[model samples]
Target chain A: MKRKFFSDRDKLEPALITIFAGVFSVLVGVGLIFIVSKDPVQSVRNFLLGPLLRTYNFYYLLIAMVPITFTGLALCIIYQLKYTSLIVDSSFYSGAIVATAIGINVSLPPGLHPAIAMLAAGLVGGLISLLPAILKIKWRANELVSSLMFNYVFYFIGSFVILYYLRDRNQTILASMPFQKSFSLPKLVENTQLHAGFIIAAVFVVLVSIFLFRTRWGYEIRITGANPKFAAYAGIPVATVALYAHFVSGFIGGIGGAVEMSGLYRAFIWQMNPSYAWDGVIVAMLARKNPKFVPLSALFLAYLRVGADFMSRRGDVAFEFITLLQGLIILILASDKIANYFKERRLKRAALSHDLAAQASSAGGQP
Target chain B: MIKFIISVFSSSNYWFIVLRSTAPILLVTLGAVITEQAGIKNMALEGSMLWAALTGVIVSAATGNVWAGFIAGIAAAVVIALILGLFALKLDANAVLCGVALNLFSTGGTVFVLFSLTGDKGISSSLASKTLPFIKIPFVENIPWVGKIFSGQNIIVWISVLAVVVIHIMLNKARVGVRIRAVGENLEAAKSAGISPNRIKFLTLAVSGVLAGMAGCFLSMGYTSNFTSGISAGRGYVANAAQVVAGGTAVGAIFASLIFGLTDAMATYLQNIGLPPELIQALPYVVTILGFVVITLIRDRKELIRKKKLFEKDRAKPLASGLGA
Candidate 1:
């Protein structure tokens, strides 16, 4: 009998690799700060401990996680369908515009107004996402290129709407009129500035988890993604499933945009794409496109963002340092050779053990 | 509308604007063609261009030499391309994801460095950067109508045109080009013939980086006087569309870039005619998407026809064999 160096049945190798990558990136970030900062020790201290110093900073971290969790879940749904749809950015912007428009113009009862506004946002996002899906299905156009280009189109359109139609005449800046106070999301905690959007995000995470694992449509989507030809041969409508996946993902992204803006700001004040969509991509990748892990991943990213913001305020380090760290971690975790090496070795060992067991069993039966 | 069209066609300035806009796209598209020919999808063109633009501005301002700026810009882009290649080839990472991450990193990193160096996050106007020189061809300048179209352009414009011809000849007649195509078409076959696919891919990407660097130099030093954040804009993406529409051919990429440039110029022209500025700004992207759809449709039709012909040949083969027997 041979002693094994490691257990072949361990399923946490990829997760461990990702953790290592994260730690390595943090070290690199620390080194960067050392090179750039005059007071390197203080800078590191602020970067690591600044977010934990005050209750307000912790609340800010929670607020930051609200939109990221939604975006992360959205990306997870789209990735499960096996398409890299970059349309989420456009969907998010369009959702913000729709929500703002509805919130300002459509007068309704208190609770119903926000609900209708969010629904409108989701619909607009879904419509915007559908274009790229149709193009991909009908003409085999590359989704990544088309979606990225569409983001510019939507940006200009959103700006046009804000500057031309919905401009608050008294305000100097180009922005939509402020939504009614009755429409603002209710505060979740009494003292702190937490909003209902965080709760909505958590609910969405659970819903998405159930949607991906328990539903028949989810099963069909998984099958289509895993093997499109086999799904088609089995009478599954692969194209429709892919399209539905895009629509659902975009809808969630729209909800994210609506909740984020309504909960955080008084008016639609963004002049450009706020880039939550890109951040969502990073979160989804970190979670490995698992809906169940989206909350943890989103919280991790939001913590870094808040920590970086605090560091920038207190020290010489810029907030873009977090972006650099994100890029490094993504590259490292996405590297197949880095993350899959241990898993591949374990798989080989398992195969060898199975072979040995089979030979011994066959010899005994023959005797 | 007719008068506007006639004026646009008659004005040599319009043509010059078109040509100027076309230079960056053409150079970038040529790089894309080379990389695609070597079977490597180099989607980090945008990041490479952005970094190159920053380096070009900083180096020229620091050294007070335009040529040194160009060299530094190209060197920066080449280094980025090599890093991308190391990830895509050696580490087996998804090229698209890496490219996206690189773009984000470049955007953030450049601004971070800019702030560190000059305490400004928006533009490099504080730096005394010199622009690339414009050349007025002595003999060509004397001509009446053609001179207006060709003379007094940036030196990079002439180089871009020369690059097109050089790339065309290289792809069609050079041994390295043949080897790259072989590796692109069949990796195992090329490996059996004693060619290393990874080396070819790495070299192709390096060349691609140099071209992207030239485009960046044109943007900062030729098109504008100073480097601004987001200077590359969506030109790198437009170049990708042009390269795809060109079917990875040098001459076709030149023509495709011209079409995109024409649309871009038209958008600017429309801005002068009281059109909504936002819609006008979006024209290039709209045209690119429309052009992509048309190209995809045409290719699909051609593929269908080819398949039908093959089917017919298969049906006729047994009958011909029976007659021979």
Candidate 2:
């Protein structure tokens, strides 16, 4: 007989795994502290407890999270459609590059440039995102493989544009000309360097949550993802929904790129960002692809990233110690069977106590 | 033109350069082909290859043996591939997500390790490492076209060719080949038949790792003298395309690899001919895009024909029923 106390679908597993991942991540953070600094313990405390120790660092962490939060929410749209096998990350990168390209090129008024850049990023990202969607629906091509390949194509194109065409010869390194100062998002805080992008990101997340939970189109996407054949039988147009999902995913991903570029750097910087698209994927995964939860997840990740960077600077440890820890955590999460073991033990003990109480009550009544 | 042909054949230098460039990509694609045939989608080949290359270089630098580096490279790739296989096949995580994670992990882990190792932020040098050497066959130069293509090539080239034959035979003629094909076709049916789909997936993934590892070895130790931080630059995706274009045949994979090799060579030639570097650089991706378009067209056409046949079957079915009634 199956035990009622330890059902397979218990939420406790996820909770335990989350705690384990957090602790493991901090442990790695401490190790990095030792590697980089003479006093590893102090370094760990500074990193884990340091950001919280100062109101300034905490604000910086929030500022750092602005772009990722936007990107992460945008990613959750595609993740919801179960088309994650396709364009989530590609959309994110394409958005950033498109936004950067326009932000650097256009000589717009200062107040309008940020908005224009964000929209441009979204549109570009969205358009590129549709390539794989079109292929998948029209020709039955594999979305995952094609989207993955398109990223490289975009990389080469972006690099070529940045290096030969747009590169600022005045600068020591290869990068774009200083983006028009007009493109900078308005500064919000007095003492800190945080921009208005954080507020914008938060607002966008709420809007996405509403669209995902309340809209008719969103319902169709959910139904289609849950069961395409059933959705088809129910008269939902699977092809149209799938295409729409890809298009929207691409659009938001693009916006993420634009916001990130405008908010963080004065100009288009690297040939590519450190796979922010992939980080968006990580965020989406941690949120279990929920549009509402992505903001929180993105912030958590951003905190870890910001803390790790600070830790490395303050101590002797390399930045890769964090990556190894992240990988370990992700690997554990991927294995549901292994992750659930910790939670199962807790439930087993709880059930044993309940049985013992029932036996003692019956014995007392008989005496 | 005659001089060009003669120059190609006469110079071991030309053959060596071509062989070196092609070997890693070919082996990597062959590994992808193994998984593709087993109906497993693999985008982690790039990550596996990168990881293997990093491991191979580090091991060779420490051990002072090219062969030891080669083994270490293969081992590194296999371990990564095994993790992917376990996640994809056993745990039911999305294969594509696993591929993405592997790529991310490889990129970050390698950079972290590189920073830790040499305190360099970019390419690692060949200061203390042993690189694989090109082998020249004795008196084979006396033969015809076979001699030109086969002799004085990287050992990886020979291994890749042998791999093609081995994979072809194992996939087509062996009992296990039948099971692998069955698993690819329908997992549920394979499970009902007691063929164990997960087992086949694991096996194919292992094979993929070995091939990808060799490819990494060829890349770091065979083709290039040193390893760069961003090595295996999207070769894995191309390998997937090669597998798809080849229609899951090992021989077809070789032909596809040749096409890619020729395209890469064409890009180099274009660069040499003073084509804009931007245009020249775009060549590989442009070619891949074209490949995707052409392949999609072909697949659509085939699907159309199949639909027509089905329609004919339905129409004939009505006439037969009417006559019988």
Candidate 3:
């Protein structure tokens, strides 16, 4: 019963591998800066320290983490359903449009308008996301492709709504009319643009963590994700679980879009996909699809992004250096061989000890 | 609307545009078919096309030769495919994750390199890039409508058409094609027969890279003369949809790509009308989703019929034997 340091079933092994992958990728990022920048040392210094040099930049980093936290949580919920649904992107757009329309049209009181808009946005997003899930359940269509194609459809519809229906005639740029002032998320930190969305994101992290781990429905979802056949055998309605998971995932993404727009901008201004949904995939992976870790992972990505922005401003290094680093990290982290090598070694040793103990015990019994 | 449709279809120029636009999607879809046949989901097609487009523009600009650009573009895409294979096959990484990473890398990395080379994040207009020349068939030019439909298209268009035939023959008849299909259908059987599945997958991805690279070159050198950020747009995904709708066959993919190409042409044509640009731009994607739904429904129905027939056979066997006795 002696515990080994590097056993196959050791809980720390994945964390160790992820940490090593992170360090390795950071080194790769620095090496890339060396190759690309004229002053590699200055660029590296700026990338590492620039985000913390100013309070505003630090706040900007926090602000950036808000949207990704929502997306990361959204991805965590849907990915557990065993579907690689890209409909989160469409849901984000649909939610933003719905929220914008409500914010502009509704005449609710100051305290109620933004809340109502966000709830409506979540509903729209959930409905939009349900299309692909239904398609998968009913017709056996590939969810990934359908969802991807749906993103473009929803994107255009959202754009058309903004351009044709909600256009502010006074402005030349293609944007919807500004939301009523009362509809915007209140500033949490004055003069730094940090808003209540951060608070909501944090709350979401806790709520999603509880939902995924604490409830009977959550247990059913986990079982369904781990094995659909087993869940079916266990009398869990697998289809219903999938539908609910998709809705919750899309609901989170929708709220993210609404909160992001309300927090940062006054109007509906996005003409293209903001790619937060794509970044969500990376965040979820970095967090290993754990809602509890989404905040940390989102912060890590946001910090890298803010640092990249600062480096681009101060040095010759392009902001894309972070993307390259992210790609390398994901490639390394998702590689099973890296983790499997240690796992197989530990398992082999355990098997050998098991065989030796069995043989010795049998010999002693015979004597 | 009817008049607009009639006017668009009656014009020979619309057909020419459809033919021209179909080339890239056809090439990419054929590449997708090859990789999918080898049981590798080719999600990195977009990244491959984007990287190839960048390399095509840069090398063509540097060398002032279009053929050199095409070769370099293919080489760059092959390198990407090799890396993808290294991760997905050798290291046992999730293919989808590797694909998403490659796509994000291509989007950012292309702009990063573009900025480094020309200090422009948007377009490579500063580079004096050479485009592939159009080829006019001498005898075909004499035919009235046929000539207009066939003559004076980009050379890549003809290559893509010829590729469909070559791929069809290769997939159905060639030794490598048989091995790829075997590996795709049953990895255990192929492995038990001493065939290396990983090697076959690597080769399949490499071949896919070549075709995707060619498609990328077509975008830069035939469709446009300079590289732009996101030049591949969603054509890579559309090609993938085409492959899926075609059931991963070369001929079917080509025809499906043509339908998408027609939608593209229609979108362009519709832009001149009073319709909003957003709706026009969404036509191809909407059509692709509809195509997928229809195809899935047909496949499901066929499967149900097959199951019913099997059940009927099982039920009839005992009764038929009893009657015979």
Candidate 4:
């Protein structure tokens, strides 16, 4: 079969769509806020432009971005390996549990505290990620189902551990014990919420980019993902790479979990944390699973979340509108086939119009 | 002997509780089976249940009738399922991702509506949440062995049992059921035989929604008599797990559901006994993990045995082929 026109721009189209979709999402979000609140104009202004002005909120925004950065990085790692069905969401939760367990249990000195906690967290997350890999290799169980199911296991275990053993009795609210200074992330800008975790996240982003694009392992991962049979034929251990991809993905997700816990919260606040896993999945998708774009995507999501918080608090709109907007984006992104169909139609129309104009100009010259 | 007897009788309550708790999960399992068999992995069971719970509460409160709530819940769930079906089948959105989207939407939409209608954050109609009446068997109480199983259960439990039998019969005996299975097992084959895969998928999802809706009714109107933000609480996923374990068999689904229910009941029972509530609550999930492992192991073992049989059969076949030559 002959290839159709605009087939070459198929890859480029999604990037354009993503950029436009982001702006469209923001606009729709603003419209929803306006519907609920009296001053639609002011609500949009407050949401879009307000958070950047306040130094404290701005720092909080970056702090929020920290976990997202790690999750996006983790997702990118998995994506670069060519693994689909994006299973890192639950891995992040499992990772957080590991970090929290350490934070609540171990008493380390300040300088090494956060580092050790993060390392412990990554280990747990990576181990959890291995479940799906093992299942896929041994029993031909789908990784997506396995990882999704194991998320509940992680939640149950984490909640059990936190609520039973590590729970802070002094505080009436349900949460874990506060971490020792040794396990906590170091504060960088004295009074600001921005912690050293942000620096670490940035460093990891760069490392992930390098690992994905410049390394032999990365090439192996891509080769396996593209064609497992071909990769196997070429002597690549497809199963091992699949397992390792998840491990690295889970490791980063776990670190992100720990970073969020130590950098921001004093303790494990609830049985569940913010859906950093979902956010990470979305961030990864938005970046087309590109390692280089994870940092930016993570920051964008964090900004949206922080901005939503700021808007709902200051304006009359409910923060639930943020979820509605997120849903719209997901629906659109998942409908990539639909998006491409429209792009094809538009290109065909453009070509026809160009042909008609040329014929009209040629006839006029002959006359 | 005394400890064994005490454990048996005491754990007998555990058995009854397991039966009771399995009701929602069984409904969800049945729903998931139909959808999965139709080649549509309906991840929106949780969302459907949540919305159904909300609608059940709303209709029951409005009409003061539990049946009305039940019907309304099914209708509401179907609406949500249709919306999801539209996006998935017609728009060609990824089914699993769409499921995830719908689940998110359910949480947000329910909470948003809850705030608008009741000014409550997570729950609604505290004064209006009413439990369905439990039916006591009139004559079956006299039976010796069957008496314990027949007496004092809600109408929905009876419906759940009936549903299993009906679904089994339909799946195995009926032409519609055959078509549905064919659609799922091999879409192209079904299409070649004049069955529209898309229509089959949509109808299966709709039926799944109704089943899930009944489960939701069992949750809010049947027992809890309240609507929470996420009252389904991962039961949908549990049902998905159960469906897999059952290999889409209705009888297997019921048994799997009962097992999960027992896990849940044990967790709750342990909590009631002054064990750490969180640890007790984790029991079902731990069991779920174990269940996945066990199911996979059993499958692998069965496959190995089948391969061995095939090898033996092949040896005999080679001699037969040589004799023919």
| Candidate number with greatest DockQ | 3
What ranking of all candidate models by DockQ puts the best one first? 3, 1, 4, 2
The superposed Cα distance between candidate 1 and the true structure at residue B83, in angstroms, equals 1.5
Give the distance in Å from residue A177's predicted Cα in candidate 2 to where it truly belongs: 2.1
Model 1 ranges off by over 4 Å: A1-10, A345-367, B319-325
- How do all models score by TM-score? 0.94, 0.87, 0.95, 0.88
In model 3, pairs of residues that clash are: none
| lDDT at residue A150 of model 4 (Cα atoms) | 70
True-structure lDDT of candidate 3: 0.86
Minimum summed lDDT over a 10-residue window in model 1 chain A is located at: A1-10
Better of 1 and 2 by DockQ: 1
Of 3 and 4, the candidate ahead on TM-score is 3
Would candidate 3 be rated incorrect, acceptable, medium or high by CAPRI criteria?
Answer: medium
Tens digits of per-residue lDDT for model 4 on B52-155? 99888888888888789889999988877877888899888877777777877777777766655676766775538567788889788676545565566677
Q: Kindly list the per-residue Cα lDDT of model 4 for residues A98-198, writing each as its tens digit.
A: 78878777777786777888888888888777787787788766555566667766676677777777789998888888876666676889988788889
Among the numbered candidates, top TM-score falls to 3
Clashes of each: 0, 11, 0, 5
**Against the true chain A, what TM-score does chain A of candidate 2 give?**
0.83
Model 2 scores a TM of 0.87
Candidates in descending TM-score order: 3, 1, 4, 2
Residue-by-residue lDDT tens digits, candidate 3, A1-367: 3355346455567768777877887788788888888999989888888789889889999999998899889998887777888898988878888888988888888758878888989988998989999999999776876788889889998888988889898987778898898888889987879999999999999999999999887788889999999999989999999999999899999998888877888998776778788878878878888898898889888888998899999888778767777887778877888766677678878777776778664344321
Candidate 2 Cα misplacement greater than 4 A, ranges: A1-16, A25-43, A54-56, A85-94, A335-367, B1-18, B140-151, B314-325
Each candidate's DockQ score against the native complex? Answer: 0.63, 0.37, 0.64, 0.42
